[model samples]
Target chain A: MTPRARREALTGFLLILPWGLGFCAFTAGPMAISLVLSLTKWDILTAPHYVGLANFANLWHDPLFWMALRNTLAYTVLTVPLSLAGSLTLALLLNRRVPAVSVLRALFYLPELMPTVATAIIWTWLLNTHFGLLNYLLSRLGLPQVAWLESTTWALPSLVLMGLWTIGGNRMLIFLAGLQGIPEELHEAAALDGASRGRRLWHVTLPLLSPVIFFNFVLGVIASFQVFTPAYIVTNGGPADSTLVYVLYLYRNGFQYFQMGYAAAMAWVMLLLLLAFTWVQFRLMQRWVYYEGGATPG
Target chain B: MRSKWTSVLVMAALAGTMWTLGGGSPAQAQKVTTIRMVWQGEANELKLYQGLVSKFEQSHPDIRVNLETVVASSDPEYFQKVQVIAASGDYPDVIYGHYSWFPAALAKHFLLDIDPYLAKAGLAKSAYFPTAIQQFSDHGKLYALPRETSSIALYYNADMFKQAGLRTPNEYYAAGQWTWNTFLTVAKKLTRDSNGKSADQPGFNPNAIVQWGTVAPVNMPFGLFPVVYSFGGDVLDPTNTRCRLDRPAAVRGIAFLQDLLLKQHAGILPSQAQQTNLFANGKIGMMASGYWDIVVTGSAIKTFAWDVAPLPKGTIQSTRVATGAYAIPAKAPHPDQAWTLIRFLSQPDNTMELAHLGLIIPALRAAALSPEFLAPGKVPLHRKVFVDALAYGRLDPRTTHWAEMVDTLGSEMDLVWTGQKSPAAATGEACAKIDALLQH
Candidate 1:
C-alpha cells in the first residue's frame, strides 16, 4: 500500500479502537462467559462443575420454566399489540394542526420520562384494591371490587395495564415522526382525485405508517420478553407464582439462589428464543410491511 | 514535552505521598487498627449503630471502625448478598448476619470457628440462651456469636376482646385453656362485619367482612411453623437434612390456618400496609409477629389497649425464634481484630443494652430476665411474651437452600390460603419440590 493510504488506514483504526475495545470488554466478554457458564452447575461459592447439557435438560423438564415461558409469551402477545394501538392512536390524535400540539405531545410523553421505580410506586397506589381510585369508581357504579395485584388471574394483566401506561412515550414519538414524514402532496393529490377521507387514509396514510408499526412491534417484543421490575416489585411472582416471568426467574436463580451458572444458561436460552422470533418476524414482514419506496434491488 | 514529563512526575510523586499518608504511619497503625463491620438494618437503626461506633471509637482510641450497612427488603436477600461477598473472598472483618446464614457460611468455610475466642474472652456458653448458641454451632464447632434473638408471640388487642365479651388471652393462658381450638373460637367471636355481625353469623360474607379477628402474615415462615409444630409437624427432621412438609401434623397445621381465611373467614391476609396498621387499629384481635412489631404496634395504638400473650398451644406447644449473630469471616484480613469486635459485640452488657432498645430480644438468658428488661414499658407488654416463648421456641430449619425453600413454599402456601388448593395437595407438591432441592 502507498504511504498516504497506510497513514489514513492507521488513523481510521485508531479512531475506531476505543469503541471496538469497549464492545469486546463490556459486551462480548460477558456474552461468551454466559454461554460457557450455561453448561455448568455452580452456586457462587464453589467452582463450576461442567455438567454438559444437564442444566438445559433440567430446564426442559421443569414445570416452572414452562409456566414462566407461557406467561412471558402471553404478556408479550397482550402488551405489544395493545401498546402499539394505543401509541398509534395517540400519535394520530396529536398529529393534528391544533394549537399547543407540541405541549400536548410533551404531556403525553411525560410518563416515559419518569423513572420506572417511581412510576411503579405510583401505579401500585393507583391500582390498590380497596382505596384505589379505580376501585372507588367501580364501587360508585355498584361494581364489585377487583383485587388488582392480589389475584392470580389478574396480576399479570395488571402489570400489562401498568406497562401500557408508558406506551405513549416511545410509540407516540415513532408514530408522530412517521406522520410528519408523510408528504402533504400525497394527501392533496388524493383529495384532487376525489378520494374520500377514509379512502385517502386507507390508500396512503396506513401504507406509509406500516414501517413505523413494524419498528415498534419488533422493539416492543424484545422489551416485553425481558419484563422483570413490575413482577419483582409488585406481585413478586405471587398470589401463586402467576407472574413469574422468565427474567424474574433468571434473577432469582442468579441473585437469590446464587446459581449463577444456571442463570447464565437461562439467559442464553432467552437469547436464542429472541433470535428465532426476530428471524421469523423478518420472514413474515415481507408480506405486510410497506416501504415508501418500492423494495430495494437485492 | 519537558513540562508534561515534569507534571507526570509530580502527579506520580503526589499519588505516592497521598497513599502513604492516608494509609497511615507505621507507629500510628500499631495503635489505630481499622475494622470493617457489616450489618443490615433500617436507616434509623444504622444511625444508632453509627452513634455506637463513634462512642466505641472515643472510648477505645486505639481502634477505628468502618460500618457497612445493607438495607435489604427481606432476610433472604440479605443472606444472599452476604454469601456473594463471602464467595468473592472480600468478606468484611465482622458480619452481623442471621443464624440461618451460619450453616451455609460454615459449609462454604466462610466463617471463623469462634469457640476458642469465646473461651479466651471468658464468655460462658451457659450465659447465652442454649438455643441461641445452638443455632450457631455445627458438630460442636462454634461458628458465630449470638447478638440478638427474636421469638414469635401472639400480640392481641385487649379492647377487641372486651368489646366482643371475650376473655383476654392471658386469662385463657393462666387457666391453661389457650389451645388452638379455643383460640379459633375467640377469633371467630371477635371477627365482625360493619353491620355488627360476627363472622360466625349465618349470613356473614367472607369477602365482605370489614374487621378481621386476626392478621396472618404468610411471608414469615418463622411465625407460621409454630402452628405447624403444634399440629405435630416439623419443618425438617432433627438433622435438618430432609423435607417434612408431607407429614400429617404439618398438613393439619397448615389446613387449620388456611381454614381461618377460607372456611371461618376470621383472619385478614396481612399486606405491607396492614402488617403494622391492622393490629394497631384494634381491628385485629390477634396476630403472630416478632418482637420488632412491639415498638411499631405499641406506638400506634392510642385509643384502645393492647398486650402480648403466649401463642396458643398446638400438639407440640412450640414457637419459633429467629436469631442473628456476630460472625468473623474466614477470609477476614484482620482475624485478631475481627475476633475482638465479635467478642465486644457479644458482651452481655452490650447485648442487654441492644435488647433494651426494643428492637430484639436479648440472646443472653440472664440479661433477658433482668429486672430492667422486664420492666413495664410500651415494649415490655409484648417483650415479656417473646421472652417466655423462647423456652418453647424452635429455631427455623437451616439449609443451604432455605431461601429457595421459602420462595417455593411461600407461593404454594398462598395457594392454600386462597382456597385454590387443598393443604394436603399443596404440602405434597411442596414436599416433592423441597425434596428435589435437598437432593440438589
Candidate 2:
C-alpha cells in the first residue's frame, strides 16, 4: 500500500479505537471468562473447581430449569406474533395522511417510554382481582371479572398483553417505513386489473411487507426469550412459578443461589438456542421473503 | 523542542493524578480505623441506623464508620448482594443479617467468630435472650450479636369484631377460649360477602368477599413456623440434617392454613404489601404479624381500632421468634472496632432507646422485658402478647442449607396455596427436596 493510503487508514483506525477497545473489554472479555467458568463448579465464596461438564449435567435434572425454558418459550410464542400483528396494524393506521398523525404516533408510543419497574408497579394495581380498575370496567360492561395477576392461568397472558402494548414505539415505526417503501405502481396496476381493495392489500401490500415482518420476527423472538424485569418485579416467578422465565431462573441461580457456573451454563444453552433459531429463520427466508429488485430477497 | 515539552507536561499530569488517587487526605494525619458497615432495608430504617452509627462514632473518636446501603426488594435479593460483596472481596467490616442467613454465611466461611470479643466484654451467654444468642450462633460459636428480637402475634381489628358482634381475640384469650377451633369460628363469623352473608351462612360467595376474617400466611416462615410448632412439629430434625415437614404434626399445621385460605374462605391470601396494610385498612379482622408492625400499624390506622392478643393455641401454644444481628466478615480489616460498635449497639441503654422509638423489641434481656416494650398503647392495647410469646417462641430452623431448603419448600407451598396440589402431596415433595439439598 502507498504511504498516504496507509496514513489515512491509520487515522480511520485511530478514530474507531475507543469503540473497538470497549467492545473487546466489556463484551468479549466477560464472554470469554464466562465460557471458561461454565465448565467449573464455582459458588463465588470459594475457589472454582474444574468440574468439566458437571454444571450442564446438573441442568438436565433441574426441574426448575425445564420449567423456566417452557415458560420462556410460551411467552415468546404468545407475544412475538401478537406484537408483530399489533404493531403492523398500528403502523398501517398511523401511516395515513390524517391531521395530528405525528401526535397520535407519539401518544401510542408513550407506554414504551415508561420504565419497566414503573410499568410493573402500575400493572399490579390495574390487575388487582377485586379493587383494580380493570375488573371495575368489566363489571360496568356487565361481564364477569377475571383475576389477571393472581391466577396461574392468567399471569403469563397478562404480561404478554403488557408486552404488546409497548410494541408500537419501535416495531410499528419499522412497519410504517416498510409500508411507505412499497412501490405504488404495483398497487396501481393491481387496481387497473380490476382488483378489489382487499385483493390489492393481499397481493401487493402484504407481499412487500414480508421482509419487514421477517426482520421484526427474528428480533422479537430474541427479546421475548430474555423477558426478566416484569416477572422479577411483579409476580416474582409465582403464584406457583408460572412466570419463571429462562433469564429470571438464570438470575436466581447466579445471584441468589451463588451458582455462577450453573447460571453460565444456562446462558450458553440460551445462546445455542438463539443461534439455531436464527439459522433456521435464515434458511426459511428463501421461501417467503421478496425483494424489490431482480430476484433478490430483501 | 515543543513536542518534548508537551510529553513532559503530560507525564507530570499523569503522575500527579496517580499520587492523588493512591493517597488519603493530607490534613488527616491521625490514623482512623474506618469500620465499613453494610445493611439492606427501607430508607427510614437505614436513617435510624445512621443515627446510631453517628452516636457510636462520637463515643469512639478514633474510629470512623463508613455506611453502605443495598436497597433490595426481598430477603433473597439482599443475601445475593451480601454474597456478591464477599465474593468480590469488598465485604464491609460489619453486616446486618437476618437469623436465617447465618447458616449460609457460616457454610461459606464468610462470618467471623465474635465469641472472643463477647467474652472480653463480659457479655456472657446470659447477656441477651438465650434464643437470640442461639440464633446468632452456629456450632457453639457466636458469629453475630442480636440487634433485636421479634415474635409473631395476633393483631385484630376491634371495630370489625364489634361490628360482627363477635368476642375479640383478647377477650377469648382472657376467657381461655382462644384455641384453633374458636379462632376458626370467629374468623368465619367476621368474614362477610358483599351481600352481608357471612362465610358460615348459606349462599355466601367466597369470590365476592367484602371483608376477610384474617390475613392468611401463605408460605412465610414467620407465618407458618409458629403454627407448626404449636402442632408439635419441627421443620428439621434435631441434627438439622433432614426435613421433618412430612411429619403428621407439620402436615396438620399446613392443612389448617390451606383450609382457611382455600376451603373455608375465611382468610384472604393477599400479597405481602396488601397483608401489611390489611388490618390497618380495616379489610381484615386479624393478622398474624411480627412485633415490628406495631410502628407501621400505629401510624397508618386512623379510622380503625386495633389491638394484639396471644396467638390461638393449637395442640400447644407456640410462636416464631426472629432476630436481625450485627456481624463481622471473616476478613474484616478492623475487627476490634467492629466489635466495639456491635457491643455499643446491643447495650441495654441503646436497646431501650430503639424500643422507645418503636423500632424493635430490644434483644437485651433486661430491656426486652422492660416497661418500654410491654407498655400498652392505644392502638395495640395488648402489648404484653409479644413479650409473653417469647416464653413459647421457637427460632427458625438454622442449617447450612437454610436458603435452599426454604426456597424449595416455599415453591411447593405455592402449589398448595394455588390449590393445584394438596398439602400432603406438596409438603411431601418439599421434604424430599430439602432432604436431597441437605444431603448435598
Work out the TM-score per prediction.
Answer: 0.91, 0.92
Best by DockQ: 1
The DockQ of each candidate is 0.59, 0.51
* lDDT of candidate model 1 versus the reference: 0.82
How many residue pairs clash in each candidate at the backbone level? 1, 0
Q: Write the per-residue lDDT of candidate 2 for residues A1-298, one digit (tens) a residue.
A: 9999999999999999999999999999989989999999888888898999999999999999999999999999999999998999899889889999999999999988999899888888887777788889998999988867767899898889778768778999899999999988998999999999899888899888988999999999999999999898888787678888999889978876768999999999999999999999989888888766647543
Reference contacts preserved by each model: 0.69, 0.59
Residue by residue across A89-120, what tens digits does model 1's lDDT show? Answer: 89988999999999999999999999887787
lDDT of 1 at B214: 82
lDDT of 1 by residue, B1-440 (tens): 99999999999999999999888855553567898988898766777778778877777777788998877887768877877776676768988988766666777777888888878878888887888888898888888888788888888888889888889888999999999889889888888876878987887766566677887535448657888877789887777777898888898888888888778978877763462375786678898888887776777878888888888887767888878888888778887888776666666677666776678878888888887888867543545778888888888887888778888898888788778999999989988898888888
